[model samples]
Target chain A: MDNEMNYRKSLNKSTNKKVIRIGSQNYVVNAERFKEFKKNVIAITVSVALAIATFGYVKDNIKFHHEKVDISLEVYDQMVDKGYKPVPADGEWDYRYELLDGIDPFDLSIYMGSEDALSILQYRGYESWDDYAQQEGYKNQRDWYNAQKKKVINPETKSKGGK
Target chain B: MKPLAVGEMLTLGDEVEYVVMSRLNHNNKDYILFANIDNPEDIVVRIEKFENNELCLMGLENSDEFDSVLKLFGDQINNSL
Candidate 1:
């Protein structure tokens, strides 16, 4: 009976030693450090995704605007072809300068052409001469052209017309 | 096509402000002429000298009216004095 008890005690001591060795070798990783690493990775991924989305949106908007301007130009040309007459100012004028406010100059010039005076008159649908001149840019261009008209003379005699 | 007379007034379409002048020929028999718009500067052009036709243009200062004017009036210039 004494021998059996001593054997059982020895067995228990060996099992406890194994359990301690296993627990020491396999350590649990630091939960706080792991969480911080995951957060940084997520932040970087979100930033990159946002940047790509922004770039795409900007590019698409520019393309859409350009196409819209192009379509507008085509419509204007069609209107002109349909017997739309330009309403002239009071007197004969020379070069008319129409100022386009709050618009892209290059794009406006391309689609509308350089004759801003005529374009405005056509756009406004003014039938009579007086109604057309009342527009802001129309009056300005007409006035400027009128001032310059006196200088134009016959190339041969360099004299003003008798009429 | 006949050459543009001295007193003839050719109205360039809505975009431009110029009249066709008399037609002359270049070295290649291409019809060309002097034009005067509202500006004092005399512009040389090649145009068809029609009696009462209007030519539409885009820009007054920098226009391809000269070329179009030439093509349209080249034949008329050949017939002019």
Candidate 2:
């Protein structure tokens, strides 16, 4: 309390001027008017600080309310039955899948003939099938390719490879 | 056969093109979530199995299996947010 009083005293002493200068003209400063002005400024600052704190609290409360509602198994079944699919929030699609120990079973950079795919493989430092297969924990290129092939169902190439 | 990357669209036996939304590998089994191209809301979740190197989408016949997958997917989305 003593420290706060001293601080306020210092502030007042610094701001309270005896004379006001207006374009080379000196006028007597009104102490009452100066005090009122300072009071208003302080009030406005407090009000703004309070408003910001309240906003943050309300936003957190709303987020907590949303998290409280757990989707039960029955509710999930009903949603699927009604043809409503689970949709992730924007920019959060990457969280939908867990790439089993950093090994992506769906990564087709090895099989794609496109330059874009080749660039991706090169970017990953894989110069040959041997490098890719070894890095991917496969014994060889054929084994890795065979394992990955079993996960894909391409209708366009179905008749060609008995897929 | 080659690995079909996620987000790729392909026609099925019904001749309806569907978009592969995502894949979830849980409990030693792989599952795929897909949606009809025309109506994305019309979605389906199926067990992805390879028999004799042939990929097949099998319907979730067991209710418990379906429930667990649904819960796992729901929890993941919630936690991500």
Candidate 3:
């Protein structure tokens, strides 16, 4: 056919060039440049692809290097035997009557483990927060603080600060 | 140069085939989301342009542009979901 002959002629004319295919169309390009471009494209694409894939995999499976260990109950029991009490749950103390007695609420330092907090915990038949946290198997006071913050302190249905 | 449409496919020099999933314009530039035909989950975004009368798919020039394009695609995908 005349069309087949023309196609053959065109292909024979560009013997030094490479055909770059995009979808269904083809473009004749410099053979050496096309090879270099393909190499660069493959390298960059493989790297980016690996990065994107590893991101999803890492997001789901990889944990922070400094992971907090679960509290060891055995260590906790030993501390309890040494006369340390566990940190009290909400509503364990009644500060309402104390407030009425003219003791400053600020002096209680309720959440803060200040000297006032130490005194209050001691008065309530429990050891100081530092001792309790150590007894509770926390690595350090900071670890205890962070762990306690994440815990649901008080439910709204259960009133606190009252007898 | 022929602009690739969604659902169209192209084969690279390595013989790996990719299918265009979506196309959009952001910051006055055009981009297309394409994935390995064999592995649909393996997706990559490229800047769509024409050079010397040939369609070219190029990597984003900067991370800022990459992030913006990523956000645009993320928002669109999230909305669909």
Candidate 4:
């Protein structure tokens, strides 16, 4: 019995596999189970990461929140009713923009429609921007617009350096 | 003062959003106005009520009415100033 025990102990040491002895029984730890568990953990982690990334991409591209969707829907319907056909989503269409946090004023030109702009001002019965500015109690259109913006663009610098 | 007292944000034909200035009640008829916030420009539209009582904005082609509205605004300005 001692000889057999010594032989098994030597075999276990040579194989580099863990072996557990309980009373008169020997139980070998299964390396395959541990390898399977590690593989599953890695696979689950990768899948979760992929799912999160895909969700973000879809949300940014085609998904709008319910409120935006509803407002846009009504706007689109009214536009269609006014004989304005919905063109394919094009670059000319400035439908989406980031919300202003009130720190940086939005550039009105970005949202200005030249046609609407001219007509609206025309309604004021002014032949030109300068005329409108003076009649409407402003120094100029630029001044009035700046007043509306409540913030000035790049201020002019006094000439501190001159040859 | 804004050219249009009451305003709503609207997207025009080019898919740009703007605020329609005001709906003025003149002689029991409504006139809708659009103004560029950044510029002192405006579009004046007379209100047209459809068979279903749905109101739509139409260009103010009537020169007489246009003059009247302009005068009204001038009066308001004078009063405010």
Worst 10 residues of 2 chain A by lDDT: A19-28
Model 1: residue A65 alpha-carbon error in angstroms: 1.1
Query: How well does model 2 score by local distance difference test?
Result: 0.43
lDDT of 3: 0.47
What digit string (tens of lDDT, one per residue) describes model 4 on residues B18-81?
3443355788765554432222222323443443343333445444455455445434433433
TM-score of chain B of each: 0.35, 0.74, 0.80, 0.59
Cα lDDT tens digits, model 2, A1-163, are: 3333432332232223322111111112446534543455434333333332333334334433343232233333443454543332562322212221232322423222323234445555678665677677777666666554433322233222212
TM-score of chain A of each: 0.29, 0.25, 0.25, 0.26
Tens digit of lDDT per residue, candidate 2, span B1-81?
333445555554445555555578997777665545454433445666665565555666453454456446544433433
Tell me the TM-score of each prediction against the true structure: 0.21, 0.30, 0.37, 0.27
What's the lDDT for residue A26 in model 3? 27
Model 4 lDDT tens row, A109-128: 22333333343345445576
Off by over 4 Å in 1: A1-39, A85-163, B1-81
Q: Per-prediction fnat values?
A: 0.00, 0.00, 0.02, 0.00
Interface RMSD of 1: 46.7
How close to the true structure is residue A78 of candidate 4, measured as C-alpha lDDT?
A: 49
Q: On residues B5-81, what C-alpha lDDT tens digit does candidate 1 reach at each position?
A: 44344433223223333444444333334333333122433323233342211121222333333334434433442
CAPRI band of model 2?
A: incorrect
Candidate 1 per-residue lDDT, tens place, A90-153, comes to 6432223233323332233334543554554545465433344344233443443332222221
Candidate 3 CAPRI grade: incorrect
Real contacts retained, model 3: 0.02
* RMSD values, in order shown: 39.9, 32.0, 19.3, 34.3
For model 2, the stretches where C-alpha displacement exceeds 4 angstroms are: A1-163, B77-81
- DockQ winner: 3
